[model samples]
Target: MSQITSPPRKARQAPVPAAGPDDGARARRVSRLKRRLTPYGFLTPTGILLVILMVTPIIMVITYSLLDGVITNKNPAFIGFENYAEVLTDPVFFKAVRNTLVFTLTSVVVHFGIGLGFALMLNSPLLGDRIKGLFRVIYILPWLFTVAIVAVLWRLLLSPNGVINYLLGATGLTEGQTEWLANPSTALAAVTFINIWSGYPFFMISLLAGLQGIPRELYEAARVDGAGAWAQFRHVTLPQLRPIIISMALLDFIWTTQQFALIWMTTGGGPIDATEVLSTFTYKLAFTRYDFSVASASAVLVLLMSMVLAFFYVRHQKSRD
Candidate 1:
């Protein structure tokens, strides 16, 4: 009994006070929530603007595509896909689609090739920083020129009596002056080349940014493992730049497919339909032929094509991740 009671009872500790509402912690949590939510608050105006400008127009186009009258009429009769039927059956529509595919594919391929080459050159040690900056400016200058102005400038250059033909004659590169944009055989090629020249700089800049982001340590490690220039490029460089290349190519395809100004101003879809693309075709349908519903249907087709491409691209990116 004495042994059982021998252990002195420890003094009962005072009960700790309960937290009073934790107002400071709640205030901190509320502050954090505000910080996280602030960006969306700032973006609300721009979101509203895009909804008004982009979404509203897209909806209008879809609605108009179902009708069978020009916008000038007070009442546009809903034809229910007849406009799409007309567009699908029109031979010119098929030709325009073919031309657009060919132009976009060829231009984007060449753009990637030439742009990657320039990016490599710029990233090389051969160029000093100042030289690199100068070349960058020179390459992007043509792209920065408004396409309308570029179209006019290139028209002058490609004309039979212009500086390009004169230079070709002087250099003995041609037997005589050649029309780059007039002849059916040369119109598509000439337009594709001009577009390539103007647009490749975008790819170059994008690829160069990707290149700069790649760790130099990777190249060093590859070199330590017996990687040569080609080996390093094939393994290290290409893999690193693949995402940028794909994204740029996707965007270029979409944009180049919609090319109107250059083709219209330079060739006007030409001696034949050599340069006719969906954009110019749609334009002709709307203004020249005064068929607004049909034009809207064609535009809807263009939008659908772009969406399909984007879907595939996004799927590919997700699979990679």
Candidate 2:
């Protein structure tokens, strides 16, 4: 009876194997790999887009610049730098360059002056906050309008018998209906003024922020040192704002040089190319005249010019940092 034989002794069971070091190591390696690849995975889409949109087009345009009869010829012939030489020697190109210089320099200078003046006024301790806020709203109104709207609005204002013309007539500021945008003599000036009006707000906002960030202790010390308002502004405010001013001016120069939409919409680079900048010159070459190769060359030249500005800007930023 004890003879159940201990219920047929239970069979020895094999102990379950513990996880090995190799398996744990493998899991850690997988996790590390995932961490390393996550950022690249996120950037993959953006990298593809940049290559497709920017890099591809740049390469194509450079290639086009070196060839002749691109887009119009099935098998374009290589012309080397001939297109560049032609573009460089072209009188129209020089005219465009001159116009671009005038437009950019005038806009940048006037923009800075006007912006700095407004920023100083707004930052004045004498001005009430409510008054400053109202002025800010009014000053920023120009920047609120789209470039297209600005172009259209100014076109209407500068048109013959428009409100501006009516006022000028009433005031006897001019003789007959002066075509502000159509007359070669006035077209460039008119476009430059429009650009200045539309762009100054950007400088104003940036300078205002910079002004607010300036340490008040500096001003107090200047005052304690018997420095008058002009001296304090010259020594303290100007120096404090120099970095912002330089950076803003450089950026404005680059942007203004590339300005096409405003000029195109306002004057179409018309009145015998009076307002023609490089951008319009290139546009007319490519689309209007169907000279893609020459246009590509012009575009490449402009890109090089922009690159020079960008190099200086980058160097300045690095020095600041």
Candidate 3:
């Protein structure tokens, strides 16, 4: 053993080579580069789309709003707030704002109310399952129909001697034919009704989903605690559905406020602009009058109002949460 001397200590095996400093640094740098590029690679499509579709259009609108109507082609000469001044001063624009608010609020409220009722009815065990399904289908059918088709159908029905007037006459409710869409007073109301009809089903489906998500145990517990039907609804269902209700109301407001196709196709904001909302007004300004700057200014104002409403809605929801 002593002679062996551990075989010269096995030649004292050479120390294993460690990675070079530059190699380690290079690996770390590659990892960091990959980490940096991964998120950007994922977001690249969305960023590009926003830049092309949303940001570009918004910038163009703002640019046009600052220019004169005659500056469509070539270099646009900035008028420096003249368009804003005109829009703010215009009575028609103010009227359109008022009408838009009224339409939005009224439609939202009515739709919510009717849709909530229908949702409650459908959720009831007393109703036959087949009947509920049939009703749901019927209600949702209108929502699936194209806006142009709905407008045309309603326009035909609201004509002076149309089906509605015919039915009213048959029922002895009216003396003769009625021009529902022709009269200014009734035109807005009629359009509002049609909007409600088309929109309520969406609210119904949404609220029904919310309602069905609630646990049946809650209702049973409420009943066991001697809560009546109305009390149970007041204490349980309404509370549980609050978030959904508020969100749907806000969505309905935005949709109804910005609606153009139905109103344009049905009345063209006619009957003396009784049904004219901001969208229609903007369209008339830009296309009919060829005042793109004023139109863009008005559109910007509308966008601001929508943003404010949305901000409040989101804040309210967060606070509730």
Candidate 4:
């Protein structure tokens, strides 16, 4: 056997197989699936939070609005749009709407004017950087304060025996102490002024950034074309800032209409409802009168109004993009 063994029969070895097209294709498909799922995996947490916090509350509020005495009544009966009808017909609601419009419009206009003026000053080449920096600090001081702080500060200042009264008396602007916050004739104006003071800095900062972004070449070209200062501002400056102005105005409109903290802390919509706004109206209905159903209806109406503004805002932003 040792002599005639055919060089020791080699053991048969199984052939190694080549990779198939199906294997490669399956790998590519797995890779593609991973890429697509990664983003969704990241967004899942945020989506869950939004659903829990925002969507859930909105649905609850809407449901409450359709019922009668939702929280107060043990068995809330579905009343369809009756609450809405009541809210729409109430004289106080109408008054609140009017006041809201007036307050919001006035604050937005004044905020724009003040913000533009400050932004212009800040952007002026005539001023030194140091001066600009100092002014910026001063201008932004109002915005640095929280709503609670601003409310308290303004209340003290506008009090009958406060510094403002003393100054008015000293300057002979008024002979006696004026009850600014307590008087019906002045309460609305007082709160409005306070709101303007606090809000203008937001517009100012935005406008200043916008002003800086305006190309100097445009102004130079305007000058070469014999455009005066006012003309240049009307054409070049206004045109350049138009987008920012519109965006800011719409945002301010939305924010001011929803203002509650400052109004609540400062005036509580008091002085015979002179300063009553939609937010305050809804709040009074819910907490003051314990009318949750009506308050929910009013809140839904406010949400609709805000949605309209938001729609325009989104459209404008898309156009710009």
Best by TM-score: 4
User: What is the C-alpha lDDT profile of model 4 across 109-166, one tens digit per residue?
Assistant: 9999999999999999899999999999999999999999999999999999999999
What stretches of model 4 exceed 4 Å from their correct place?
A: 1-16
lDDT tens digits, residues 98-211, model 2? 999999999999999999999999999899999999999999999999999999999999999789999999999987788999999999999999999999999999999999
For residues 90-160, what per-residue lDDT tens digits would candidate 1 score against the true structure? 99999998889889999999999989999988989888999988998888798799989989899999898
Give the Cα lDDT of each candidate: 0.89, 0.96, 0.89, 0.96
lDDT of 1 at 24: 77
Residue range 48-164, candidate 3, lDDT tens digits: 999999989888888888888644657667798999999999888888888888888889999989899999999899999999998888878889989999999999998987999
**Residue 274 of model 4, lDDT score:** 96
Model 2: residues with Cα > 4 Å off, grouped in runs: 1-37
What are the models' TM-scores? 0.84, 0.91, 0.89, 0.94
For residue 110, what is the lDDT in candidate 2? Answer: 100
After superposition of all CA atoms, the RMSD between model 3 and the true structure is 5.6
lDDT of 3: 0.89
